[model samples]
Target chain A: MKSRIFVTLKNGVLDPQGKAIHHALEGLGFAGVSDVRAGRLIEIEHDENVSKADLEEMSRKLLANMVIENFEIESN
Target chain B: MRAAVIQFPGSNCDRDMAVALRDVMGADTSLVWHRESELSDGLDFIAIPGGFSYGDYLRSGAMAARSPVMQAVIAAAGRGVPVLGVCNGFQILTEAGLLPGALMRNAGIRFVCRKVRLKVENSQSIFTSHYDADEEITIPVAHHDGNFFADEATLDRIEGEGRVAFRYAEPVNGSARDIAGILNDAGNVLGMMPHPERMIEAMQGGSDGRRLFQGVMEGLIREIA
Candidate 1:
């Protein structure tokens, strides 16, 4: 079994890196760029017996800092 | 007072913290490696020093925060032990959930390294008791991901509870609300980007940081006495 965790900055939080990337794209003469936000995708391999609760626990404990980021888990 | 400094694989300031606690704070101190499970019994304080712990892999202090020794440190903190995390240590504290907020890349994406002026926001903490509230002190800050970030409500709660221990007197890093340092809800755990251990002596440019360690030592000594 495997799970993928998507960690992203919450809405209304300042994404400085994303902002820099947007600025760079504009500097390169690229148009139609409304916004850019950066985040991390972590893939984990776990046993089938692992429950969704367990994966959520992992996200809460380490993958995403609940203070500044939000995490979503997808398992297959 | 018995103090222990946790040394991760790449932690360069462990010795400096040990020296600050032992020599300046006059407390019996020991260096506990990242692999150690058990700290010395009856430890009064734990110092998590700066430097690139595990090369700051995954994120700043991410790998080091999961090391075996941190479990013991977290347990100790739950028992009311004073834990001070400086720079990389601050990142680890946040990663380990011992403190709130994440240290993002500097707002300008630069590694800021210099002496920064910080205002002691809360003089009543176990770590900041020696300083007057709002007093400005200069301390060296050397870090790449020292920009602190948290949601507005959490920030407000921390401020309302007086958990914000230090704030930058001037703009240094693009920290939210210019927060240079903060304490956990327990008030025993402090995570800050400034290197207080580096400023413990006049020969090191200033002794402004000496009072923090000394204050903790005195507070703990009084508690156990």
Candidate 2:
């Protein structure tokens, strides 16, 4: 199975890197960008026996810091 | 008194921490590597020093937090052993769930490296007993992801409980509530961005941080005496 996890800062958390990217875009003359947020994507290759529960546990235990971030797992 | 300074693979300040504890705090100290699953018995103090642990991979301190030695440290903390986490160590403690919240990028999105002024918020903790409450002190803070973040309710609770040990006297990082350091609910674990170990001597520009270590040593020694 292959799984993809998207880890992002929780809502209302400050995203400094994303804000910096927005600034760079504006400097390059881009417009209409109201807000920006940054996150991480992690892809995993695993055995077919890996279950959704396992993936979720992995995300909870290590992939995402639940205090300030959330993780969504998509596996097939 | 005896102390253990944990040394992760990328830890640069382990020796410095060891020296401060041994020389300044007058405790026998040893450097414990991250891979060691168990710490020797009779450790009076544990310190996680600052550095780019695990190369700051996955997230600052994420990988290092899950390493074998942290389990022992966590167990020790549960037993009321005093633990101090500085800079990258602070990040690791949060990642390991020994401390609350997470450290994010600085609001300015820059690696803040300089001596910063901090106000001692709680002079009652073993970590701060030597300092007067609200006393301002200068310490060196060198980190990229030192911006502390926690939800409003969590922030309120920590603040209300007086768990906040230190707060930035000036705008240095975009830390929520300007908290530079905090103690865990058990009051045994402390996570702070500023490097107290680096400022233990006059040549380090100031000895303000010396009192912090001094307090812990005195507090622990008193119990034994």
Candidate 3:
């Protein structure tokens, strides 16, 4: 099975890269732009024996930093 | 004093840390690779130096924190060994759960590399014992992600407990409350963004960083004696 993990900064945390991207978009004359936040996506392949709990544990242990980020696991 | 400088694959500052400790501070130092599961027994101090460990692949210090050698380092810290993490090392400490808070991307969205001023916060700790209360010093910081962040409650608790070891005298990286360095609850582990090892001598522009290693070595000698 293949799964994708999305890691994102938690609410109220500042996203500088996202902000810079937004500024660059405005400089390019893009209109009605809202705020932007940066995050990461990790794709992993595991045996079918792997369960959702295992993936969650993986996310908690390494894929996401619990202090500043949250992670969601999606199975493909 | 016997010290171990942890060296990750991309660690460029390990030699600087060893030189500062061995030559200036007069401690016998060794560079321990990240893959080793064992550190030298009876280590008085361990240092995590600055660099782009693991090429900063996932996050600064994230991959290195989970490497084998860190477990040994963590065990040593549990036994009250002094551990100092600078720059990327600071990020690894936080990632390894040895210190509180996460170092985020700089608020200005740029890689900061320059000498910045810092004020000693808790000099009573072993790490800052050589510094006077609220004394200002200059140290160099070079990182893209030195901005420190934690929740308000954790911030209040650590501040109330005097776990903060240093604060930026100026807003250099937009760190929360301008925090530059912090100590663990036991006060044996200190992680700071500034590179104290680099500033250990006058040729490096100033020698204010010398006292940090000096103080720790003295403290260890006293303990051993």
DockQ head-to-head 2 vs 3, winner: 2
lDDT tens digits, residue span B64-128, model 2? 99999999999999999999999999999999999999999999998999999999999999999
Clashing pairs in 1: none
TM-score of chain A of each: 0.92, 0.95, 0.94
lDDT of 3 by residue, A1-76 (tens): 8999999999999888999999999999999999988899999999989999999999999889999999998997
DockQ, each predicted model: 0.56, 0.95, 0.89
Question: What value does the lDDT take at residue B223 in candidate 2?
Answer: 81
Q: lDDT for every model?
A: 0.91, 0.94, 0.93
Of the two candidates 1 and 2, the one with more favorable lDDT, higher being better, is 2
Supply every candidate's count of residue pairs whose N, Cα or C atoms clash at under 3 angstroms. 0, 0, 0
- Which prediction has the highest lDDT against the true structure? 2
> What does the lDDT read for residue A72 in candidate 1?
92
Q: What is the lDDT of residue B26 in candidate 1?
A: 86
Tens digits of per-residue lDDT for model 2 on A2-71? 8999999899999999999999999999999999899999999999888899999999999999998899
Per-residue lDDT value at B91 in model 1: 98
By DockQ, who's the top model here? Answer: 2
Candidate 1 — what's its lDDT?
A: 0.91
